[model samples]
Target: MRFQLGWSLVWATLILAGCASSRPAATTSGRSAVDYNSYNEDLSSTRPVYNAPLTNVTPVTRSAAPSATAPAPTATRKNEIRKPNPPIEALHVNRELDLILDTIAIKNRTVRYAPGFRIQVYVGNQRQDADAVKLLIYQNFPELSPYLSYNQPTYRLKVGDFMRRIDAERYYASIRRLISSAQLQADKVDIRRSLLIK
Candidate 1:
């Protein structure tokens, strides 16, 4: 074991010495291996020298000044007149179009209702009861304009034109204090009136 250890140390020392000797020795000039001075010398040799004579240059001649009696040049413009565009005939709409427009106008004038939900604040056969409920809603919650509409034997006082049941449900929760029996019902809702209420 002692013999083997001594042989290993000798092998390691030999390997290290071989590696050190294989590398190139550094120069004493203290310059890098790139030799920047050679590159600078090459650049100086290729550079152009500017010691040529100015024999090719021509002398500039000055012109005489214009006399005060001579008139200055004036720019003249050609006369150009643009012609007017020809008149086009007015559009002739069909009578059927007027009928269609009249129909649309009549539809706009008529109460256009959408399939929506409303909170029924009161539903009774008595007109006075419906009016009272309407007045109660108007006085207490003016923002929610209660609509009073009669259908045959009964008059319903519905509050708010909710496009969705969720909206009616929300409004019902708020007005539940005033009208505990208020319930969401599908009704013909006026979109314009609903927007105005908001």
Candidate 2:
């Protein structure tokens, strides 16, 4: 009975210690308690009130320190707003550079075909297999133009007239999901078709 009473006393002491807070009470020292009702009055008294008219106030102009040779710049009035000069319309070009650019553009325009990339979806002897793959690509990606051509015994199925290999790789990745045989190949791409497809 004595042992049980001692354990109960220890538990009671632990419970009391856990429940009791050690933090000190909040103190205001000498200042009075903050009154929320006089917020506007307190704010007004603390803020510096400006009596000057804002419309007449000119912005202080910052400039480089004046040299003896350079004349002092005239003071700008608040009302006298300076409009920015119109943007330069005419572009000055170097005659030699302009000629070379024009030549390159003309040459590119005249070229109907260029060595580029095409995503070959399938290449086999069976025409039906090629047609099936083409149909699959068409259904999944309507934007991609699939072409199936028979060359002698073998049939070829190619998709997308991509000028760059990077572009061809992008389409190949998506097509690979549907057709395992999809491959990126180098071919003469019609510039018009490539541009239109993109």
Winning candidate number (lDDT): 2
Which digits, one per residue and each the tens of the lDDT, describe model 2 over residues 22-114?
Answer: 755446685445556777544776789866433433354455676698555444454443323323342334566788899999988999989
> What TM-score does candidate 1 reach?
0.41
Q: Top model by TM-score, which number?
A: 2
- Which ten residues in a row are the worst by lDDT in model 1? 74-83
* Model 1 ranges off by over 4 Å: 1-111
lDDT (C-alpha) at residue 60 in model 1: 33
Alpha carbon lDDT of each predicted model? 0.72, 0.76
TM accuracy, model 2:
0.47
| Backbone-clash count (model 2) | 0
> Using Cα atoms with residue i matched to residue i, what is each candidate's TM-score against the true structure?
0.41, 0.47
